[model samples]
Target: MEKNKISVTSDNIFPIIKKFLYSDQEVFLRELVSNATDAVLKLKTIVELGNFDDFIDDFKIKIIIDKKNKSIHIIDNGIGMTKEEIKKYINQIAFSGAEEFIKKYKTSNIIGHFGLGFYSSFIVSNQVQIFTKSYKKNASSIFWSCDGSTNFIIKEIEKKNRGTKIVLFLNEESKEFLEYNRILKLLQKYCKFMPITISLSSIEDKEKETIINNINPAWKINPLQLSDKNYLNFYHELYSHQLDDPLFWIHLNIDHPFNLTGILFFPKIEKRIDIQKERIHLYQNQVYITDNLEGIVADFLSLLRGVIDSPDIPLNVSRSHLQSDPSVKNISKYITRKVADKLDSMFRNHRKDFQNKWENIKIIVEYGMISTENFFVKAIKFFIFSTVNNVYFTLDEFKEKIKETQKNKEGKIVFLYSSDKEKQYSYIKEAKDRNYEILILNSPISVHLIQKLEFSYKEICFVRVDSDHIDKLINHKKEDKCYSELSETEKKNLKNIISSNLMENYKFSIKLENLSKKDYPFLIIVPEFLRRIKEMNSIGKEFFEKDKEKYYQLIVNTNHIFMKKILKETCEKKREKMIQEVLNLTLLSQNLLHGKNLTLFISEKLENLTKK
Candidate 1:
């Protein structure tokens, strides 16, 4: 037994550790539990090598809460500390800088990135007492005690245990640690994946010991050893409160450039962007690290659910350094690459299944492609475009299929899409009648992605099927025919009357086109470029705000009998009512009629029906 002062860089070390070294006071439990797990794992390795003679039959870490005494003890049956080992490892603060330590020992399997985790216990406790018995043959048991200062005492003690027990005397400010439920929650959050059996016991109920963690998680074992049922069961175990199951999972086993192992699950996401959250749990040798793995996993891919255990990820460092680290960037890139590869494989191998799951997985894929250029490049061949009829096609395949029919006059393929199937159903039908394929691009992000896709492809353009005249939607015509001037003049007057009946919020381009008499007389066409710019501005994207106003074309069919009858009506009041009704119907079909305008339209129609 010896009495001495702890070797540290400064006398103010205790204050720094208590206030600043760790942001969360609760992390002290994590640090202590992690150290216990490491000690157990180290003993296991030594036993495998036949170095330790006094072999323990069982190994586990136990947490005992004594509410009356205001003390919490973390007990572990592992390799205990000798006097010399304690003085060397515990007395001295690991102050030799991160770079020096990392250069000396590149392995992270030995404790945390910083070997100062033991001292973290000092952050929450007024005093800490350690009772230890070395596994070495004929070794004496020892007691080490320290208050929240540089002073510590080591002495020989009588003990029946073959391990170490750390008893923390909770400080006045940190008395919450003495609560059984508080300790239980922390254990479940950060220590749940530890590679040792962890249990909790209370002096109140001595017989029942509750085991809290699965020491051997499915991610830590050889993935080949697991079946699909096993994987799903583990997911349910990890996320029991979440009702929906994961769509699919990728068992990542990489040993080449860096050692990494984990399972990444594509979760069943709500068809909304706001509900996406980072559920990717990170671990180091089965010890929980951080859930906010922003730089380690791509921001968009962080929405996936599962576990990632990497001994090579330098997650124990400072936040700024972690964000800028080259290994972290590589890790981020590697994860996206692997995810892209997996998605590509699934898309190619089981297209039917992929399509079935596409609506659920589309958010991640589109978000990833928009957020990362590397993923977009790799995912080009795999980005599928599905039509309203449930038919799916890759970018190139869709283009080739439509090249002969949908090519424009300038030798460019014009891809027609609809934002709303029901509102744009008539336009879709018109395009379908002309043998033109229309894609369903209604996802909120699709507008941004389509704009980006157009930027990538100079020879292609995407126009909403309702954005232009049906004859011009495909640009199949190579010639133009002259029309009668008197008919054109009458169509101009009809356009003027229609425009006068509506609000001035919209910029209307009224034109007459040759069409079947059965076709509707009035059609609304929203231009693609203006509509996209306006949509971008709505989301605070950099675009012309003033140009964000709504604009559409009111196409009148002079060849249709209904249009000719409206133009040829003699009674001015009935003629004006007919024009207003026709224009309101067009606006309703475009989903642009709302509020007071819709109410007034409904009222006018009711009044006319009553009079008739």
Candidate 2:
């Protein structure tokens, strides 16, 4: 046995590595397994160059848990080092700094760009032993051991096998990793897509060995070779817990500028459904890196779930945290462009299917369009405008269909929409009767998106269906002489009587219209400006929330027979009661009446019926 101090610039490197270089104890296993993969890949390269004559078969990495002895072993059938090679590679630590090594092989697919990866063993173990045999001729087997300090032992051993075996005597703090389920989860997370076959014994079948990883995933293969079914199967395989299938997926591959490969799936997320916020798993050469890829993935893309493998996104020595660099921004922009292209293709080729899925997926797409300027610029053309009638249209199609009728005399194309169809049924019906199409924009971000459209879409404006009278919404046609107009004094008296009964918090204004007698006697209208401000307040806009109190327009139709009866009644009490009942019913239709008010209205309706 030959023992010596490790050749390093600092003697305290081991303590620093355990304390600073690595923080997550679970990464020790990842580092060991990745090193084994690197060793096999190195030998494979020699064979490809025709320098090595041996026919290599059965490449695999195995993880063994010896619970009784408090040790975990990572065994690999890969190229191993002899005595002299061990001294040069292991003893001379930090010879090639992790930063220098990674910069040299930044473009390569090799996982261990950092020489310090092997030292991560100190994170969870107090002592580690390595038994290895080199494949070279005249190479004797060797044993190397270190006790989480500067002192280490290297000795010649009589070994028959040609590979490396690492045994970690776990520290008391890291004994939790000995749990079968915990180790199994780490293996699934980090090594599920690694190139090498990982062998492990399962909890259910303790006697049998199982392959935990899929060596070849669909993202690495050509998109043309994969069918929709193939992609779907992969999706469910990656996310076994998810019950709903993805609406579609985009296979992203790029070699130039920067290396990036991924598959992003858009699940069926509707406005009514709570945003599950599927995280995008970011990887480096099939090794799991992180899912919190905020800087690398646009905020809006967090709704999409998938795997992104890119050697360009650099990580620190521990491979724990991602580095925020220019490459990250470049990759993010590329992904955004790729998603835009995919959506554009679907809209142009499979328009009907795109429309069918629009209502389910539009919230995310709209979010992307609103948050990302580049996405908006590229995807605006393919956006589908959905109507209350369940019909869909592209931005241009809807614009053309309504350009002649929906545009005001000021040349602003109006997009009339409703938040709740049930609550605003009377308003929507009135708009639809005049042959005007009402778009349904009811998502949480609808108000903000409408504000964004006002700026993005030149000479275009969006108004809620209940914002104003139908005649004012589309002023293209002349109003019909449906009923005689009421004088100013009569309108003033009508406003005063309504205000006396309604609560002060609800400020009501009176508007006179010559609508048909069959139309609603009174329609409650919330101005688009105030309603939009209220919407913003509900979603973290505290400045707008302070004044989000609601005020409404109570439009009285002069042509309605009941309005004439109330106006002509001689008994003040009877007239006031009739007016109050009509106002209460209007409020009820708008969902504005609550508890006591709603109960009183119901009681009044029953009493009037009994009197009749």
Candidate 3:
């Protein structure tokens, strides 16, 4: 046996590693397991190269927890280290054996880029030991031990098996790592899709051995070999608790510019827009990295759930966060383009099926279109608009369909939409009466999406069905002539009567329009710009509390008999009562009549009916 100080420039290297090297101490297992995986892959590469003649039966990594001894053992049947290699790799800090091996064998399968992975064990363990035997002719086995310090002991030892066994003696602060459930969860989280088979067992329950990792995950396989069922099964495996299966998926297998392979699933998102981040699990060479891929994935695509593996994605030293790099931007753009292409293909090939799935996927699609300009440019070919009648049309199709009739005086095509199908049913009906298509833009982010669309297509404008009177919704430069012979003075008096009888708490501007008699005597119309701003503010909660009062325009139809009756009434009291009833009806239509006002309106209607 020989003892020597670790070859490092500083005596505080171990302290730096334990306290600041890794953000999460639980990642120690990931680092150690990744190192083991690299060893196995290196050995396999050597065998494939015909350098190693010995026939290897199996390649696996086993994690054994010995709670009685307060230690954990990670045993692997892979390329192990000899005494001289141990002295060079284990004693020297930050000198990577995996890097050197990769350069020598020209293999990209090695997972460890930094030699510091072995030292991560000290984050949870006070002392770590390794018993390794190299697969070489006339090779002597080696034993190495380090007690979280600069000093280490390495020597030649007798061993029959040609592999590596690492032992970690847990510290008191890391007692939680000793729990079988805790270690199992960490393994499942970090090593579930590793390239090699990884099994976990407790010495106390050796009979209950559990293989914790899949040797070959679906992402690593060729896309042609996977069926829809295979993809969905893999999706459920990734998110076992999710109730609904994915609507569709895009198999990314790019090797040209950068190595990237993974499956992205278009999950069934509802109308609520639950933008769940960290759903896109990022991986580096099949080793699990962080899931919060802020820089690696486009912000809108973060709403999607799946696995994205790429060795090209730059990561921090600890692999807990993404590092800023041009490669990350390229990867994000590539992913966006792939997703857009997939949707475009689906829309072109399966029109009816895509239409059927629109409601389930529109939120994500719309969000992507609104947030990513490149994605928006590609998505416009497939992004659809669905009418209240459940009819779907692409933006270009809808534009062509409405170009003849729905264009305003400025040549902007008007798009009529409703946020609430039930509450705005009357407005939708009025628009449909004039042969206007009323789209259902009820998603939580529809207001923002509409703004994006308007900015993108300057020749188009979106107006809610209830945003204005039916005729004014689309400016045709034509007006209905009033049938009433009431003079201007009489119109002013009618407005005054209604204004005096209106609820003091309500905020509105009175306007008399020469609308057809078929229109409501008193119609409440919210201006499109104000309503959209309010909706956007509601979504972002960026408005002042005092400025949240509902404001609208009260349009009185001059052709209606109610207006004439109110003006011609000989009794002032009866005229005021009629005006109040009309105001109540308009308020009820707008859903603003509530509490005492709604109760009073109901009581007065019941009393009038009883009198009749």
TM-score of each: 0.91, 0.91, 0.95
Rate residue 470 of model 1 by lDDT.
70
What order do candidates take by TM-score, descending?
Answer: 3, 2, 1
Candidate 3 lDDT over residue span 1-612, tens digit each = 999997656486768877898989899999999999988998999899999998886899999999999999999989998888887788888889999998998877788887888888998898899999998888899889989888888888888998999999999999999899999999999999999999999999999888898778899988888888989889989998888888889989999799999988888787856647439898898888877888777788887899999988887788788888988889888988999888999899999999989888888888898888999889899989989888888889999999888976687999989998989888988888888888889888998999998988899999888877878777654454345556899888888887777647576777888787878898887788887777787643446234443467888888887888887798988887777777778778778678997999899788989994
Model 1: colliding residue pairs: none
Scanning candidate 2 in windows of ten residues, the lowest lDDT window is 96-105
- Candidate 1's clash total is 0
What lDDT tens digits, residue by residue, belong to model 2 across residues 1-612? 999997655476667877888778788888889988877766665566686788887888988888877888898877788787778667766443334434643426578776778888888888999999987877899999999888999999988988899999999999998877788889998999999999876334468666779988888989999999999988988899888889999999999899899899998778843545557888888988888888887888888889899888978878888877888899999999999999999999999999889888898888888899999998888988789998888777888888888986577998888887897888899888889999999887887778887897787899888887777677655556365466778766665666675555356666677776777888777677876776776554564444333356677777778866866787888887787777777777777787887888888778989994
Q: Candidate 2 at residue 511, lDDT? A: 67
RMSD of 3: 3.7
lDDT of 2 at 305: 89
Positional deviation of residue 7's Cα in model 2 after best superposition, in angstroms: 14
Of 1 and 3, the candidate ahead on lDDT is 3
Poorest 10 consecutive residues of model 1 by lDDT? 315-324
* Leading candidate by TM-score: 3
Candidate 3 accuracy as lDDT: 0.86
